[model samples]
Target: MVGNMSKKFNSFKEFYPYYLSEHQNLNCRRLHFAGSCLVITLIFVAILKSSYMLLWLLPVIGYGFAWVGHFFFEKNRPATFTYPLYSLIGDWVMFKDIIQGKLDI
Candidate 1:
């Protein structure tokens, strides 16, 4: 649920808790992590192969997987719709947390 629908966060620290709440579903978190890994791989491939065209798929891959997670798994609206910047930051932070074992799979 988007409980913070009317709440405005002035800092990422404040937004992160809400972000985590939205991603409580295991499948949603996994999809997000997988999407992030793919995004990273795609970036490296684009740079190493000099294929700037591949860079164009970044948003499609990143947001596509995330949207699927939110819609199908989380059964909630993505924070991206309302808080684009913080939500993007939250994605990376969540990825890092997952990798570091701060969050359960």
Candidate 2:
């Protein structure tokens, strides 16, 4: 687990560029984006449906796609281990970037 201090983003200004770098490969970013989307949607669904049981699978969904990207395309370990919450935040931000067409990859 990431300590709160360790996960503290000194600045999104710094973090975003690093996020972009880590997601350099188009496929990696796409996969990560998909994972983030699935996780978020499932979370909301779990909340709305009052079904907490599936919540346990959220991490698997999130990590599964992103890990595939990291291992297969990026060839790097995910920063999630070092910065779990921040990485989660970064995931959403990157997802937004993808949806907005701000990120080509």
Candidate 3:
């Protein structure tokens, strides 16, 4: 694991580049995008159906897909283990970037 050697970024602006580097693999990015889309749809379903239980699946669905991509496609440990908050933020940012054609899908 590269955990101990990881540099502490003072801001998300600095962290984002590193995050992007971790997710450079095309399949990994696609999985993340798919997971994020599922998360959004699930959130709306939970709200519309008033089924709070469905909300619980958010992390499972999101992380499951992402972890698979990291393990199989990226072949690297997920940054989420070391930087949960920043990683979550990166996921959304990357999702938007993909949508805006800034990042390849």
Q: Report backbone clashes per prediction.
A: 0, 0, 0
Give all TM-scores, in the order shown.
Answer: 0.96, 0.80, 0.95
Per-residue lDDT of model 3, residues 43-95, tens digit only: 99999999989998999999999999999998889999888999999999999
- Better-scoring candidate (TM-score), 1 or 3: 1
Q: Highest TM-score among the candidates is held by which one?
A: 1
Q: Of the pair 1 and 2, which is ahead by TM-score?
A: 1
Per-candidate Cα lDDT values, in order, are 0.94, 0.81, 0.92
- Candidate 3 lDDT score relative to the true structure: 0.92
lDDT of 2 by residue, 1-105 (tens): 112233456876767676677778899988998888898899999999999998999989999999899889888778787777767788888888888988886
Judge candidate 1 against the unseen true structure and give its global Cα lDDT, from 0 to 1: 0.94
Model 3 backbone overlap count? 0
Candidates, ranked, lDDT:
1, 3, 2
Best-matching candidate per lDDT = 1
Candidates ranked by TM-score, best first?
1, 3, 2
**Model 1 agreement with the true structure over 7-104: per-residue lDDT tens digits:** 89999999999999999999999999999999999999999999999999999999999999999989999999999999999999999999999999
Cα shift from native, residue 6, model 1 (Å): 1.8
| Deviation from truth (RMSD, Å), model 3 | 1.5
